[model samples]
Target: MIFSHEFSETSEYSAGTYTTPTDYFRYTLKVFEPGRSVAEPIMTIEEDYAFLMDSQWIAQLPEVREESVSAAPNELIVYFCDMFPFQRSVRDDSTRLLRDEIHNYIHNDLGPGMLEAFRIQSSDWGFIWYGDWTSSRPGADSERLSVALTKNGTWYHGRAPARGHSWISISVEGGVNAYYENLTDGLISAFYHELFHNLQRNMSLELGGNANIDGKEDAWQFFTEGMAVFASSIGMTHVQFSQTTKARAYLAEANKFVAGGGLLDGELNNSYKAMF
Candidate 1:
């Protein structure tokens, strides 16, 4: 069984308004609270009664868990759907680590960093699906989020719907080991790359970009993918030389491809290579 970890449900939320210093636009957003409690339940009936009766028992209990279940005021709620039962070990190990890494980066690191960088006072909220959207268990918001989902038979590692643009779908088809060469950093960078796409979409609306994103979809692809690629670079920078070396090599290869008339616009136009 998957042990309990901190997670926020989309349902239990407090509404708040976010406004930039420029007063560009006001957004009503939801701040999600963790659905599960962190407190360790007293499994034994005798222990439960003893804990309530004795103050010493409280002191003896372990410190509260450091993992946060609540989404920060300016963050998105992420739900993981493990689609491959055959990859259970992969999910339990590397995938779980990836989940925590993504969680900490988004909620603790990136959100506050964005607020400071943008002079935004209002919170922004959305959801991210970190596994197959189709295989999501009931109540994972899969039904309502039918707007933009990963294409059924398309070859992709990750995508956020360009239309509704609220959620991101990350494909874990071959497990982190096979897909990412067993590199956790590689997995983190990949996830962050897609996450930055969602961020770009949200920030676009916040700063008054066209709501009809598809109308100018071709024009936006360069900037959209560029920002995400840059963001992933930053995400990978913590490891300094290791992943950065590989990423630079990849970028160089892409540069060569672009020099040969490759482009980052539409799916038909070699956009995948450019974005990756």
Candidate 2:
């Protein structure tokens, strides 16, 4: 059996006419074991009260302008916009490079069988304008260039956003040069890393599991990041890997995991330490 709850409210007050009211709620879920005369609660789950609010106001703003390029039916819809002239140039080139690499990796490495299993019919992937990081920018950094998230993920919470089987965002701020000296391989590696994450999420969902949980929500950064790093390195040629420091570093870490027989270890909590 399954159960759920939802709440919503609307107000007719102008911006200053009224103050929003907070609604606190609590709920409990109990599982009972069937018995001849009585049923006893075997498991009881309780949640503390929470003030849930409609967050549509926090959504991503509509794109200033967008341009789409043609791709295979199952391939990504590449959107290039919301960038300054120089950033646009870098994004344009990076988009093309990432598109080709993703296609090749999916077809050659991951294979059509895995693709069919994941049920990824099509993906919408693009680069967005992220201004260069500053001390005042808080958590903004060049590392934000590659990110993949589901429809319900935080990245899609605010503003009008496009819908697709999956959405991958690459930041166009700071330029590719700022992150890596070798532009082509660096962009390719980043794209593949995020692309693998999309695949991981899709595969988990198809298998009747939640990626955020089954994929280790608590230690996600350790496992998924390690897997993505390994994937990014393996997707490219040794020659290309030799040219990119990030790729080389990933390979080194992956090698350590393999060499230490980490895969044979039964300890799940310490697995990430081996990869590191």
Candidate 3:
């Protein structure tokens, strides 16, 4: 069944707050807007998101359901929002396909290989923000976020800040087919990239490093983004994932901008470059 837990803004160890291999999972409405509860949704988006999550078929799939309880705390807890019309048919179909792809990737890649290589277990509990969180936010930026929760095979809607959580955010703001050949393919690539970020977080924590460079366009950004790019390159093919090429194109422009004496930090396009 789906479970809902409230965390105090000041308390770090509440009832539902969990400790994964990466860090503590604290629930919040938005990272920037702390203490905002789903009780007060931005629009009707939270309720719309709940309707979609309630009817999902993947949560019932025997194999996936089994994996849902896997020891790996790094497994993805994906949430979709701003789905244009927010209907059951569209949300169900999208969620079904998305879950299938995620299961395959984790079962084949992250669980057995990547996490194994790092001496960690399979499937860490982390949230992924898929689709647009804002309807009129303008531009496809701000889509890279990690949010939400689920329990006992039931999904619940919420946002967990990426800073201290093993969170992975993704977005296809314009349309499902806007970034890649299809939404599923684009999401897979994005998941791979973010999964690497989680690994980076865990490794850093193990090394006693608590530095976070998210949103900063500095040299350290390369270590995170570049490593993710490298991981995605070696882990999956981007034939159906067109955003890779798009990010590469932007990176080329970013290179020229820096070569022309533009500072890597504070510029906008560099954010896009850092995303992929």
Leading candidate by lDDT: 2
| Error at 118, model 3, angstroms | 12
Q: Model 2: residues >4 Å from true position, as ranges?
A: 1-73, 85-166, 175-182, 213-217, 243-276
Candidate 1 lDDT tens digits, 43-87: 322211111110000011111111133211222233332222112
Q: Tell me which of candidates 1 and 2 scores higher on TM-score.
A: 1
TM of each candidate vs. truth: 0.38, 0.36, 0.38
Clashes of each: 1, 5, 11
Candidate-wise lDDT, in order: 0.35, 0.38, 0.37
Candidate 1 off by > 4 Å: 1-76, 83-166, 175-183, 211-217, 238-253, 260-276
Model 1 worst lDDT run, 10 consecutive residues: 52-61
- Model 2, position 264, has a per-residue lDDT of 30
Order the numbered candidates by lDDT, best leading: 2, 3, 1
- Which ten residues in a row are the worst by lDDT in model 3? 56-65
For model 3 the local lDDT of residue 172 reads 31
Better-scoring candidate (lDDT), 1 or 2: 2
Q: Candidate 1 — what's its lDDT?
A: 0.35
- Whichever of 1 and 3 has more TM-score, that candidate is 3
Error of 2 at 122 (Å): 12
